[model samples]
Target: MGFKNFRFQVVLRVALLVVSIFLFFRLDFKSQYVGTQLALGILIAVQTVWLIVFIERTTERLIKFLNTIKYDDFSENFSSRGEGKIFDELYQRYNEVIRKFRDVRSEKEATAQYFQSVVQHIGIGIITFKKSGEVQLINNAAKRLIQVPSLSRVDHLSAEAPELAKQLLALPAGQSTVIKLWQGKERIPVALYVVDLVLRGEDFRLASIQNIQRELEEKEMEAWQNLIRVLTHEIMNSVTPISSLAGSVAADVQDYLEAQPGEQIVLQREETEDMCMALQTIEKRSQGLVRFVHDFRSMASVPTPKKQLFEVQEMFRQLQMLFQEELLQANILFLIDCRPEGLKVLADRQLLEQVMINLIRNAIHALADQPNKTLQLDAFSDPDSRVVIQVSDNGTGIAEEAQEQIFLPFYTTKATGSGIGLSLSKQIVRAHKGTLTVSSELGKGTAFTLRF
Candidate 1:
C-alpha cells in the first residue's frame, strides 16, 4: 500500500479501538448491557493487535528478502498471493531480482570451467609464475616436459636441468631460447617463449614451452636420403666407363711394348717407362673409382630403419672410443657435449653411427695441418623438439660455393676425395627420416647437424 493510504488505515483502526473502549466503559452493569460491553472489550483487544501487526508486516518482509539474497537462498521464493496488490507487487520484484542473480552465478561458473579445460588440454606447455619464481599455474604439457607431477616454484626444475631452470626464471618477456633437458633416458630440446602480464595489478610471467627434437631428426634424414639416390645413379654410370678406359690403356701399353724389338724397346726405354707409369696410374685411378662406386651403392641401398630408442649419451661414448686413438695421434682435441645426459633418439643405431663417422672423418681431414684444431660432438634437442646431433670443427672451413654440392657423390674439393662419403652419410640420415645440414665459414669453421 502507499504510505499515505497505510497511514489512513492505521488511524481508522485506532479510532475504532478507542470507540469500543469508550462504549464498554459507558455501558451499565445490568445483564443485557454487561453482555454487550464484554463484546466491545473483546473487539477492542482484537482490533488493537491487528493494527500493530499490519504496521510491522512491510518491514518484516523487507528484512526477510534481504536475508534471502545474502544467503543465496533463491529456492525460497516470495509469495505473490493473499497479500494486497502493493505487497504482492513487492514480493514479485524480490523473486525476479533473485532469479537474475542465480543466472549470473551459473554463467560465471560455466565460463570458469571452460577456461580450465583449455588450460589443461593445450599441447604447448604453459606456466605462469610471479616475479619471485613461485609458479602460479602449470599445464599438463609443462608437467610432462619437466617430468614432474607438480611445480610449486621455477627453481624445482634445477634438479632436472640447471640451465633450464635459470632460463625459466630469467628469460625476458618477448624473447625465446632453446635448451636441452633430459627426462630419464631421453634428452629433449625445448623452446621457451616468455611474456609478461599483469592481472589484478599483480605481475606474472607466462612461458610457452615445446619439444622439437623429433621434427628436426625426421626432416634432416629425408633430405639426406634424396641426395643419396642421386649420387648412386650418377656414380654407377660414371664408374663403368672409367673402368673400361683403364683396361684399354693398360692393354695398349702392353701391345706397344711387345711390338717393339728387344733392342729397339731398350733404346726407347725412357718412353716405355713413361708409358708403364701412365698405365699404372690409370689402373690405380680406375680401381679407386670402382671402390667409390661400390660404397655409394651400399649407402644408397640403406634398408628400412630398425628403429629402437637409444640414449644419445651412449652413442657419444661409443664415438669417443672409436676415434680415441685416431684423435690422439692427430693431436686434436675431441670434445663431447651431451647436455642433460640421457638424450635419446628412435633410430637405427648402426646406420646413424655410420653417418656420424663419415662426418667426423671429414672434420678430421679439415683440421689436418691446421693449428689448434678442435672437434666437438654435441647432442641436444632443438626448439622444434627434435633430437639434434652436431659435429663441429675449428679447422679449415669449406668454401661457401662448395657447401651446397658437397653432399653429392663424386663432387669434392680434395684431389683424392671420393665424394661418396658425404652423399652416403646423407642417405643414411634419410633412411632414418632425419636431416643432415651443414653450416660453414671459409675462415672460421664448419658444423654438420643431424636432426632426428
Candidate 2:
C-alpha cells in the first residue's frame, strides 16, 4: 500500500481507540461494571478487526486498479461491493480518470496514424528536426528526395543525407529557398522550405522539399515560344516590304517593255536601260532578304555544343584582329588584358569564340559615335574560383528599362540592329554551362561579363 493509505489507516485507528476508551469509562460509571466492561471490550475488538480487514481490502483493491491502469487495461473496473461510502466514492473517481485517459490515448493514436499516412503518401518530401539541428523524422518522400539508403533513426543526417541537410540548413527559419543539389556533378533543382514548430515548450523545425525540374522546363518552353513569335514578327517585317517592292518593279518593267514600239528605238533603248537598273536594284534587295532569312534560320537552328578545352587568350586575339579595321575607322581604342599562360576553360571553343566575337562587335557599335571611344577586354580569375571575361566600353550605354530586354531575341535599340546577336550569344554561353550578364549606366558605359 502507498504511504498515504497507511497513514490514513493509522490515524483512523488512533481516533477509534480514543473514542472506545471514553465510551468504556462512561458506560462503567453509568451501569453495571463487569458485563458492561466485557461487552465494551468485545465491541472494541470486533470493530478493530473489521477496520483492519476493511483497510487491507481497500488498499489491495486500489493497488490492483492502479496496476490495471498502468497495463492499459481500462476495461477493468473497481468493484464497490461491500465497501463504505468513502471507498465507493474513491472507486467512482478512479474509473472516471481511467476512462478519460483511455479516450485521450485513442485520440492521440488516431492522429498519429493519420499524419503518418499523409507523410508517407504525399508526393513532396517532409522532414522534421529537433532544436539541436538533428533530424527527428523523415517521410518516405523525404527519403527518396535525399536518396537515403534506408529508413532508420534520422539523427545525424549530415552524414546520411548530406545534400538534403545542406539545403535545409541553408534555409532561414520561416522562409523558403531554392537550391540545386549536385548528384555526381549533375545539378538537380529542389525547392526547400523551413518553418519552426513548437511543442510542449520545445522548439523544432520542419522542412518541405519539392522538385522544380518540371516547372522550370515548362517555363523554358514558354520562353522559347515567345522567342519564336518575336522572330516571326521580325522576319515578316523585313520580307513584306522586299516582296511588295519587288512585285511592283517587276510589273512596271513588264508594262513598259510591252507598250514600247519599234518606231521610237532610241527612247525605248534608254527606257530599257533604266528599267534594267531598277530590276537590278530589286534583285539586290531580294538577295539581302534571302541572306537575312538564312541568318534567321541559322540562329533558330542552334546546334548542341561539342565541349572541349580551349585557350582564352588566343580566342581574344583572334577577335581583336577580326575587328581591328573597324576599331581604327571608328577612332576607337581597343585594349586586351590577356593572362600570360592563356586561361584554359572546358567549353565548346567554337561557341565561346562566337560569343566573344558578338560581344566585341556590339561594343564596337556602341562606341561608333563617341569621339574618344575606348573598349577594354579583361580576363581574370574570380575569388569564387571562376574564370571571368569582361568587355567594357566608354560609350552611350543602354537605358535601364531596355537593359532587361536586351538579351531577349530581336530586341534592340539601334535602328540597323538585327537584335539576334546578344540573344544568340547568351544561348551559346549557357550551352557551355556558363552565364552571360550585363551591366550598364546611361551616358557612362556598358559591361558584359562572362563567367565559367
Candidate 3:
C-alpha cells in the first residue's frame, strides 16, 4: 500500500510541477513583479531535483539487489528500519529470495558430502578416470581392495593385477569381466564393471571392482569340500576292507599253488593256477582304487604358495634342459624366447615349474599325431610391465567341448590320463596368485598363457 501511495505521490508531484511551469510561461513579467517571478522559478527547479533524487534512490536499491544475486552474495541482508512500508516490503522480498538461494546452495553441498562419504565407506571399490587413464577419483574401498596406498592412474594397477590395467582401459561401457589376482599368498578373483559418464561435456569412465571369490567362491569351495569328504569317506570304506581281504587271500592262494604235488593231488593244476590269478587281480585293482582316492584328496588340499622373485630367463633355461631329451625323441621343434631379457616374476619357482612341465607334456602328447610339430615357450613384459609367459604348440589342438572341462579334476581326454594333472596345475598357478588360460582351435594350435 505504501508503494502504491508513493507512485500516486510521484504522479501528483509531477502534475503540480507542470502547472507551475505553465504558470511561469503565462506570467506577465513587468518591472514590479520581477522578484516574485524569480522566486517562483527557484521553487520549480527545487521540486524537479527532489523528484530526480527520489527516483534515483529507488533505482539504486534495485541495482544493489541485482548485484547481490549476480555475485551469489548470500551474506547480503535487506533491512527496512524506519523506511516506509513500501521499502520495507521490497526489502523483505529481496531477503526472501536470498534465503531461498542460500537454502538451495546448502542442500547441494550437503548432497555432495553425503555421496562422498558413501563412496569412501562402501565395500566395493570405485574408480573414475578420464579416457586417457588419468584417475579422477578413487574411493578408500578401491585403495583397500587393491592394497595400494594411492593410485594416480589406471595403468598403475598392472603391478597388482597383471591384465586388469589394460582390461579397464579397453572395457566397453556397461560391460563386466573377472580378473584373477593375488593378495598376499591367497588368490582373489575380482569382478570389474565399467560405465560411461559425460560430465560438463567431458567423457569419463567409472569402474567398480569387487572380490568375487570372497562373495561367490567361498560357498562353492565349501560345497566342494563337503563333496570331497563324502567321496573319500565312502570310497576308502568300501575299498579298504576289500584291499586287505584280497591281499590276504592272494597270499594264501599263492602258498597253496606252490605246495608240493602230493598236497594238491585232489585238485587239478589248472584250477589252482586260475584261483591264484583271480585273487591277484582283485588285490591289484583294490590297491589302485585306494591310490585313486588319495590322489583326489591331495589335489583338494593344495598348500599355500611360498613366493620369491626370480628371473624368467633362468627359469626358461632350466626348463629347456629338463625337456631336452623328450623333445629330441619326439622330433618336436622346441623354441624358447625371453625378450628384453631380464623379465622377472614373484612366485613359487617349484610350483611354477611343475605347471610348465605339465603343460609341456600335454603339448608333446598333442603333437604326437602331428606330422610337423612345433613347441614354443615365450616370455616377455607386457605394456603394463606384467610378466607374460606363453607356451604354444602347432599340433592337434584340444577339442572345443573338452577345453571347457580341461581344468576340472579327473577330466581328461587321454586314455592313460589320471585327469588330475591339468587341474592340479591350474590350482598351483592360482596358489601363486596367477592365471593359466588356454586358447586352442582344432588342428591349428593351442596356447597356454601365464600372467604374473
lDDT by residue for model 1 (401-422), tens: 7875787766888898877788
lDDT ranking of the models: 3, 1, 2
Query: How many Å off is the CA of 84 in candidate 2?
Result: 3.3
| Top model number, TM-score | 3
lDDT of 2 by residue, 1-452 (tens): 43235446667776887788778877756555878777878878887887778668667877877787788887877766634567678889888888897898899999999989988889898888776676677888776666775544444456755666665666679888777654321245788899988988988888898877556644653586466657756876877776786787778766655777554534467767776776787788878767776666656666789987777788878888988898888888888896645787778888788888888888888888787899998888864467888899988998878875787766789898888888788777766666777778888889898878
Q: List where candidate 3 sits over 4 angstroms from the true fold.
A: 1-225, 247-274, 381-386
Could you tell me the TM-score of candidate 2? 0.48
List of clashing residue pairs for candidate 2: none
lDDT of each: 0.81, 0.75, 0.82
Regions of model 2 farther than 4 Å from truth? 1-76, 151-163, 182-186, 259-452
- Model 1 RMSD in Å is 11.5
**Candidate achieving higher lDDT, 2 or 3:** 3
Better of 1 and 2 by lDDT: 1
How do all models score by TM-score?
0.50, 0.48, 0.59
